[model samples]
Target: MESPLKNFAEVARKFCAWAETQPVSTENEVKTAIELLANLSSAILATSNLGFGEDLEGERISDEEWRVTYNRFGFLPFNYYSTFFNPANVGKEEPVIGDLADDLADIYRDLKAGFWLYDRGHVKEAVWEWRQSFQTHWGRHATGALYALHAWSTNESIQL
Candidate 1:
């Protein structure tokens, strides 16, 4: 079975290749490609939360469930909104998972900004933002980050 990262990379690569072969004069194709790129970013951002899975009964656990579990286990930064929203918990523990969650949110926001720039024909700015997003959070994995970097470098629709 292929990893989700591999799947995302393959799809992104194919989209870039398709975008390059498309005529820039075709507004519809360009729009479609840009949308696909945005969707790709969203997919990657969503996958950043690595550990939740559905139960045997097919019920998925809520974020609160996982948050509380992590908190009970003495995980640092136990102030996740789903579990504890108290302001007092702010400086308690410095859990790496919590930090990663924050990074995941930033990834989504940056991806949206990049896609908007691309849609508006600011390709260079879009590429720069996308590159920034990847650089900021890419340390979590080897393959996914490398593939994303390759896609960014080779995609003509992405300037800079």
Candidate 2:
């Protein structure tokens, strides 16, 4: 059987491949991509929640041990969001680590709007708006956006 970490990595790779093919100009395609991204994000969070193996005593290990375990399992490398998103790093300074986190937040905002629209029975409009927002906000670092999109899609399917 595959481990949760391995499953999460596989799903992430699938999402990235799908995102690359998503149509930036089409409303429906973008909406679908966003939904897929949301689902992918949820899966990653779930996997992370599983935590690394614990000792028989069930004590939490140090950060270094956790990192080593995660890395050894072929998980995606970690990055600090604070280092990437801090504005001070943009001009004369270097960018912080949380840049991807910032982008993910933007994607989440758009996804929330889309979710509200769908909840309000305005699926068509919601889809259109999400596509527009995605076009405006999506960048080379599309991981977060994709995760949000996947979550949205999966949730909708479950509801139906």
- Candidate closest to the true structure, highest lDDT: 2
User: Which model scores highest in TM-score?
Assistant: 2
lDDT of 1 by residue, 39-146 (tens): 566545543333322211212234564444333322212222222223256878443323322322233344445455555655455445545455564323222322
List the lowest-lDDT window of 10 residues for candidate 1.
75-84
List the candidate 1 regions with Cα displacement exceeding 4 Å.
1-101, 137-160
Q: Give TM per candidate.
A: 0.28, 0.32
Question: lDDT for every model?
Answer: 0.41, 0.43
Q: How does candidate 2 score on lDDT?
A: 0.43
